[model samples]
Target: MILSCIKRVSCGRIRPVLTRFLRASTAKHHDLESYLQFLQTQANVATESTYYKGLLYEYTVQHALKKLIGISPLTRCGGTGDNGIDLMGSWNIQKAKKKLDSLTILVQCKASKTKTGARLFREMEGVHSYHVSKSRQEGRTLLIVAAPSAITKQGFAQFQTTDVPILYCQINRVQPIYDTKQDTFRIDNFEHYSVVQGLLANHAAQALLEKCDLSTAKINVLMKGNSVEHKKASPPVVQKITLT
Candidate 1:
C-alpha cells in the first residue's frame, strides 16, 4: 500500500511538468507564426515603396488619388481607359437611416518627378480637358500627377486658383513603409494604426447598413450590453475600423 501511494504521488508530480511542456510548445509555435505574418506584411509594403520610387512620377499620381477621399486601387471606378487616367475606385458614404451611397472616381496617373512649373500645371489641365472630351459621365474625372519629389508651394498655389481641381501627390509626403521591429506602419510621416482604425469605423457603419458583418468593435460594445443609447445610432464601427 505504501508502494502504491508512492507511485501515485510520483505520477501526480510529473503530470503538471508534462502539461506545462506541451503548453510551452504550443505557445512557442503560435508566437512564431504571428511574428512571421508581421514580417511578410512589412516586406510586401516595402517592396511596393521601392517599386514606387523606381517609377517616381506614376507613384505621385496614384498617391494623390488615394489620399483624396480615400479612393484606393481596390475601389471600382466604373470608367473607361481613355486619356491619362488609368485606374478607378469608389467609397461608400453613410447617410440617414444607415444607408450607403458609393462615390466612384476616375484617376489619371502621371509619373513625373520634375520640379513644378506653369508647364506642369498646363499639362495636367490638358489631361483633364482630354478626359472631358472623351464624353464619359460615369464618374468624376480627376487629373493627378505623381511627382518623384515634392511640389513647391508656388505650384500648389497655382493649382488652387482654378475651378479645375488638380490632385498632386508628392513623393515625400506619402511614402508608405512597414517596420517589423516597431510593429508599426507609416505613410510618409503619417502613422498607419490611427488611419487604419478610422477607415474600419467608416466601413463598419456602411456595411451594417448594407447588412454585412457588424464592426468587431461595435460587436464588442454591444456584447458589453451597455444601455447607453445616448448618441443616437452613431455605431462604434468607425472606431473598430480605425484599429485595423
Candidate 2:
C-alpha cells in the first residue's frame, strides 16, 4: 500500500492516496474526544509532578520556540540559580547584502494552571529589566507565560505598560486538526497561542523588534526559516501499536 501511494504520487494521483490515508488514520484514532482525553492525561501528569512539571514546561517552550521561530533558547534550571530568567538566546537577523544583525532575547517561562495575574507580570518585568541592565547589553526582552490557562485582563493591561514585551502561549487555546488531504494530524491553533506571533503583531513588540534594528528583510528571513524547521520537526504518525 505504501509503495502504491508513492507510485501514485509520481504519477500525479494525489487525491486517492490522500483520501484513503486520511480515512484509515482517522478510523484508528476513533475521534477527537479520545485524542483530547489522551492529551488531558498528559497534562495531568505534567501538573501533578512538582519537580518535573516546571522543567517539562520550560523544555516544551524551548522546543516550541525553536520550531516556531527557528531560534534555540538556553534553559536555566532552577537548581542552577536562574536569577529570574529561564531562557535566553540570540537570533541572527540577516540584512541587505552580507550584513548581519543579532537580537538578544531573554524569556521567563511560567507553568501553572491558574490565570496569570498582574503580580506575576510585574515581577517578571522587574527581573528582566534588571538582567538586561546588569548585563550591559542592549537586548530586547520578552516574558513567555506558557500556562494552560488564561491571562487576567488587568494583567494584560499591566504588561502593556512595561518596557519589556510580554507574550503568551495558552495551551488550552490550541486546537488539534486532522488534515485529510495531507494525511496529517497537528495542532492547528498553535500559532494563535504563539508569543512569536504576538511579537510580530503587537505594536509594543514591533517597536522592540525595530529597536533591535531588525529590518523587514530580516524579519521575513526569520519567519521563512521557522516554516522550514516546522515541516522538518513535525511529529510522525504511528503506523501501528501493539499492547502486551
Candidate 3:
C-alpha cells in the first residue's frame, strides 16, 4: 500500500542518521582543551590563526607517524592548499604484499574534539578521486586519514564503501594537551577501524609490528574488519626494536 511505501522510504533515510548518532554517542569522547584555551595561556602566538590548533596537532601526529609507521621526510602542506592532503610521505607495502613496494601517501589530519563528519571525507574524495585509486604510472597513491578524535560512524561508513585503501589512524590522548610545543605530551594511544585491524592482523599479533599500522596502505586489500590499540614506546625500550 502507499502507506507502507512511505514508511519504507522514511525508514531508509532515518536509519543511517539514527545509526550515526547512536554509534557516535557510544564513542568515549574526552574533554579536550580548545585552541583558545591554549593560545590564551601562551605568551606570543598568532591567536587569530584558526589553523594553529590543527597545525600543531598535525606536527604531533607527524612525529607519531615517524616513530610508529616510519613516515620519514614527511612534507607538510597545510592551510590554504585546496588539496585535502596535509602531509605526504612514503609508505612501505611489503607486509601487505609479498614483494617490497612503496606508495606515495597523502594524509589529512582531523583533530576536532568531536567526531569528524562526512564533510571531511568528501574533501578527501575530491583530493584523489577514483583516478588515483586505480594506480597511476607516476606511482601508486594512498590516502591516510589521521583523526585524533576519531570519525563519526556515518563518515566511517563512507570510507568503508570506498574502493581506495584508506589508512584510518585514530590518534588520541587521555588527557587534554595544554602544551604549545608538540614534544611536551607524547601521544601513546591509537585506534583503528575494523578493516584496518584485519589487514594488519599478523602484524598486530607480533608485538613489534602491531603498533605501527600506517606503513601498510596498499590496493587490492579486502578491507576486512578490529580495533587495534597501540601505545608509544618508552625511551629505553624504543632502542631494542628495529624497523624493517
lDDT of 2 by residue, 1-244 (tens): 1112112211132122211122123233322333433444453544366544565455555655665455543433233335456655665545544322555555666776677678877886666656554443434444454555555777666666766655554433233454668655454434322423222222455565576565334544555565664564433211111111
Better of 1 and 2 by TM-score: 2
Candidate 1 off by > 4 Å: 1-68, 73-82, 95-103, 108-113, 134-139, 148-150, 171-244
TM-scores, all candidates, are: 0.38, 0.54, 0.51
- lDDT digits (tens) for residues 107-225 of candidate 3: 77776767766677677666666324333312245566776554566775665565455565655422333445753432333211211111221121122123323323322121111
Instruction: Give per-residue CA lDDT, model 1, range 1-244, as digits (tens).
Output: 0111011111122111111111112222222223234445444544355333433323334443344334454211112323344444443444344422543333444334456555666665665555443343212333444443444556555555544444443333334465668765433333221222121212212333244233435433542333243333232232321000
Output the TM-score of candidate 1. 0.38
Error of 2 at 32 (Å): 25
RMSD of each: 21.7, 17.3, 16.3
| Cα lDDT for residue 68, candidate 2 | 49
Error of 2 at 188 (Å): 13
Model 3: residues with Cα > 4 Å off, grouped in runs: 1-43, 46-49, 93-97, 130-139, 173-244
